[model samples]
Target: MTDILIRNIDDDDLRHIDALAAELGISRSELLRRETKDLARRHALQQVTLDDIRRSVDLAQGVLDEDLMKQAWG
Candidate 1:
């Protein structure tokens, strides 16, 4: 596997990474590797901000409802 080094990481940023790794019960390197891969995969997708999501959801307002319940359940 290729190695990537992130330089000049701030103390707080490192602390956050350490905390996240502890939370996930993994080494910081492992957590960073998994996160990096996930980010790489996600980077290829269309990026949507919170505003975009809100707008899309607003556009879809009241669209999904109990209408499909009959077909799904009965």
Candidate 2:
């Protein structure tokens, strides 16, 4: 694991973060770590979902005639 140093956070923001960490019974570092991991996981899942959708669209292209598509959509 690598260390990250964030500089110049506002005092009020730091206090709020500390309070939240305390509420969750975790250290501030642990709270930040968990949130960062969760954000990355969600982003990866979204990318996978988008790729699947694009693949499906590619596979479906030209399978339907234009007239049929228009009628189905309308």
Candidate 3:
């Protein structure tokens, strides 16, 4: 496996990372690895386009009425 080195992290952020790692009963490296994987997965999932939105709307076959908008806002 490839290793990663992050430099110049703030002391406070390092403390925060340690705290989170402690909370989850894992080492700081493991916490960072898990978080980095989740971040990459979410970034990959966010690749949407106008055509994708149009296709989703077409598949839904639903209208965006005021009631639906109000519910969404709430």
Candidate 4:
């Protein structure tokens, strides 16, 4: 496994992490690792949702344009 060093964390934030770690019965390092992984997972899921929305918009636009063309010709 690779090692990572983070610097300049706020005192309040460190305190919060310590409290959460104690509640979960885990070390601060483990809590940070889990939180980081969760954040990455959520960000990836959000990107997938955005892509789906873009595809839906493109599909809807095509359908709307086809309907408009038919109405104009009819």
RMSD in Å for all candidates = 7.2, 4.5, 5.5, 6.4
The top-ranked prediction according to TM-score is: 3
What's the residue-level lDDT of 3 in candidate 1? Answer: 88
Q: What is the lDDT of residue 40 in candidate 3?
A: 95
CA displacement after TM-score superposition, residue 33 of candidate 2 (Å): 0.7
lDDT of each structure? 0.87, 0.91, 0.91, 0.88
Each candidate structure's TM-score, on Cα atoms with residue i matched to residue i, is: 0.58, 0.63, 0.70, 0.62
Clashing pairs in 1: none
Ranking by lDDT: 3, 2, 4, 1
| Residue 43 displacement (Å), model 2 | 1.7
Q: Of the pair 1 and 3, which is ahead by TM-score? A: 3
At residue 67, what lDDT does model 1 achieve? 75
Model 2 segments more than 4 A misplaced: 48-51, 54-74
* Candidate topping lDDT: 3
Candidate 1, position 42, lDDT: 92
